[model samples]
Target: MDLHIVDLIESLNNFDENPSARLSNSIIISDYPGLISYLIQNLSGINIKILRQLLEYIPEQILEEILINETLPSKLIEHIKTQPPDYDSIKILSDIYDESIYEQLVDSEVLSKLVYSIQGAGPKMCENLVKVLVFISKHKMQEILSIPNSRNFGEILIYRLNRAQGIEKKLMLKTVTDIIFSFPDYFYINDLKVVCDIVVDSLSNQEEEILTENYEALTALMDVKDFFDLKYRFSEIYEVLQVPEGNSYILKIQDRIYSMISN
Candidate 1:
């Protein structure tokens, strides 16, 4: 083990033992400028708890500088492809606010790997991966949309949404809505119909948060008028909307859908 890593481990252990020592230990750890790069390089071997602590304590500006200067995003993507995907490392990467990191990820074609990973990921891991994709889509929609089989990625999200429950389902619904809003023209007709179906089915959900997300998703889908024809599912949507009576927002969404169909 490298001396710096050994020292970092010791510092983390001390911090863990005496939570009050956090400030001083964090300062000591931050002095080692290459710490972030070294951690990324040895992500597979490092303890996830230690990694999370180091990342959390490191100042954002310093972390950003190290990430940009070290070209760590490329290395992280390489690790994802070549090794067992490290959820903690990927989670760390996802939490980063740097646009350059995401740009490199997209340039290196990381989206496909991420989308593929979702199929096998555990629920928490799946949510983290989807959150990363949501971040990338927000920053680089055109690049993500330009990738081959991008629509397939959207379909996978819809598939996940159908099976997901609780917070996982809500996140997927929000992700789908954001994607539709960002690139409404990118989805194929079949995928758009499936998304609409998901939204319509979700209308009967009693959870206010889920219902709000479903409304936003439906609104986004309405933008893709060329592909999404609400008429086919009007009866289903109307029936579902009836289950949630007296809610003004749901009532408004119901009214909007009715107007769209009538026009």
Candidate 2:
């Protein structure tokens, strides 16, 4: 016998909880494409939010269909958006963080849109996006950066490296930029200078990660001609590193630069 979505509507309506109703309704919708398609065509007849929440996953076509459902009441539609920002905006810092960064984590779909936004957006836009990604983690950050057009993720990050001002986030930026270099076509001259500068500066800060990352950056820079220019621009940095209060790590870098450029 051909099944029907409406036939299960009565039972679906009987449940107050989301999970059971979702499981039951899924069984019905999957059983009858014709009736499900017909109900989808007449979306005004049911609560799209509940339908969306009940579905195991929202298909792109189905979401597109739902978006076009103009007959969906504004109040009910607003309720669908009742979900709040993932972070409490009341506790946010105006200068240190971006408001849009908090919106990126609403769900995976929002996060995906955010990653795409970073690709085409300018440095400021990518700045907030990277902050959000790092707030998430190296693994989640990789997921966003791995998507096509994600090479630009480093652009904002490198911009941060140059402007970073002896703060914890600034210090952490060394590792973040290093991660960005993993991209096949990234690590441009401007980016390299900013990263190398941060790496060298970390010598005073005495961060082992910074020293290690700087070595790798120098190795990477050996291949790029503009790296020689970066050395000239950063000439004063080696002098600071050479003073050696308690930082042989940084002094070592100064010696290496002297050796490389002197020869």
Global lDDT of each candidate: 0.65, 0.48
The lDDT of model 1 is 0.65
**Candidate 1 structure quality by residue, lDDT tens digits, 25-52:** 4555445555655565565535444555
Model 2 C-alpha RMSD to native: 14.2
lDDT of 2 at 171: 38
TM-score, cand. 2 vs. native: 0.43
The sequence of per-residue lDDT tens digits that candidate 2 reaches over residues 1-263 is 23455665444445454454365445533443443344445443243323543442434324344334433333222232353221211111112222344334344554455556565565544555566555544445556665665555566667665665545344346446446445424556666666666666666566554455555555455445556655544555444443336777655755676677656
- Model 1, C-alpha of 11: deviation from truth (Å): 19
